[model samples]
Target: MKKKHNDHFLFYSESKTKNRITINGQEKQHAIAVLRVEDGEHIQITDGQGNLFVCEVESVLKSSIECNIVESWSVKRITPDVTIALGLTDRAHFESAIESLTALGVKKIIPVIFEHCRKPWWDKWRRYEERFKLKMISSMKQCLYPYIPELVYPTILKEVLEEDKTHMIVADPNGSTLKSEIRDKQTPVTCIIGPPGGFSATEISEFNRTKVVYVKLTPNRLRTELAATVLCAQIIGHTL
Candidate 1:
């Protein structure tokens, strides 16, 4: 098996060659200014596509940082792709959810504007999309994860329900245990977490109309962000 660098800071770069890689934008600035990475220093890097590169810093430029690849390998993606369809909530909570889910290796996140979600919050999602992305990238690097979770903003409950045929797991207080819902690791999952206020009657009715499994994460109420992270962890535990 290939060795893992658990302590080195992981940088992200899409521009890479067989034996070379370049870190640009905020990541470049971070390596230079914040991490103070210098020539001949080794750093771990990911392409955000399941590949990790252990590299030695070649030079630091005014615009970007260049590195020579010492070794590289691919990390397999987590099995049974997990997608989180979370209700749009307050900025801080929603962003927190993004970070938490990314660290758990969720494949994708869809921000749905459910009935309980405030219209103002939904409207602001687009403006904060970039910031949300940065949070995912930060979380991925912190956990030394190879891939950044995909983010889709400004959607609705109805749209998600009809998006695909994957198994849908809805987080509810009065629902059944998660163990019964997640049986097979090969089956893809789309876990839905409502806003902090919970899903409305109409939304519940919509769920009833379609096929979905309701799993209760806990008997007590949880904040929207916490509920989302819990659900992701449960799915991973059961499936793995």
Candidate 2:
């Protein structure tokens, strides 16, 4: 089994094992203001590229801090290549979907605007992307994963399906069982989740014509986020 490190770490630039390093810019502020790390304190550092460095703070300043690297190792993370394409919904449901997908180790998230979706909000998209990125990063840090999930801006559902020939599974409560529908699928799966009111009849027909298999989670209806999470969990659990 691989060894795990149990030490606090802050991101920094100019990190090298067995040598002095420096932390500056936003990272410096986060370390000083937020963490209040002091000199001679041991901390881990990463270049955000699968490298984790063990180091001790040498000095602290207003905008930067210097540290000496004691040890370094490459971090490996388990990230699924599955892509989750979800229809845009209310802010609460949208945010919940992002958080749940991140926790489930989804690699790519594509927010789709369906026929029944509310009018797009550019500000909400930007804010949600930023917040989702931070959440993914925090989750990755907590789990010691080296990669963060990617969040794509809202796009048209038709376009996404046309571009990717992935194993497509759409969640429909009245559809076939999930296990029977997606029992044996390879990687790079793409699952589509509709809005709260679910897809319209016309939309469902179009989806079926496009060869998107509809999978049912349970007999009881579920919220948009709940359906998305269940489908995602099934895909990840089965694939992994």
Top candidate when judged by TM-score against the true structure: 1
What is the model-wide C-alpha lDDT for candidate 1?
0.86
- lDDT values for all models: 0.86, 0.72
lDDT score, candidate 2, position 140: 56
Per-residue C-alpha lDDT of model 1 across residues 1-240, encoded as one tens digit per residue: 332334557999989988999999999988878887887778899988889888888888888889899888999888778999998788888888999999899999998888878746666556777788788899999898889888876788999999785699999888999988886888889999998778899999999999999888997899988999999998887777
Task: Flag clash pairs in model 2.
Answer: none
Cα lDDT of model 2 by residue, 46-160, tens digit: 7645677777788898777888777888855443467888888787677777777766777778888887887566446665666666666555556555555677778887787
Q: What TM-score would every model get versus the actual structure?
A: 0.92, 0.77
Superposition-based RMSD of candidate 1 using all C-alpha atoms, in angstroms? 2.9
Give the best candidate by lDDT: 1
Backbone clashes in model 2: 0
* Candidate 1 residue spans exceeding 4 A from truth: 1-7
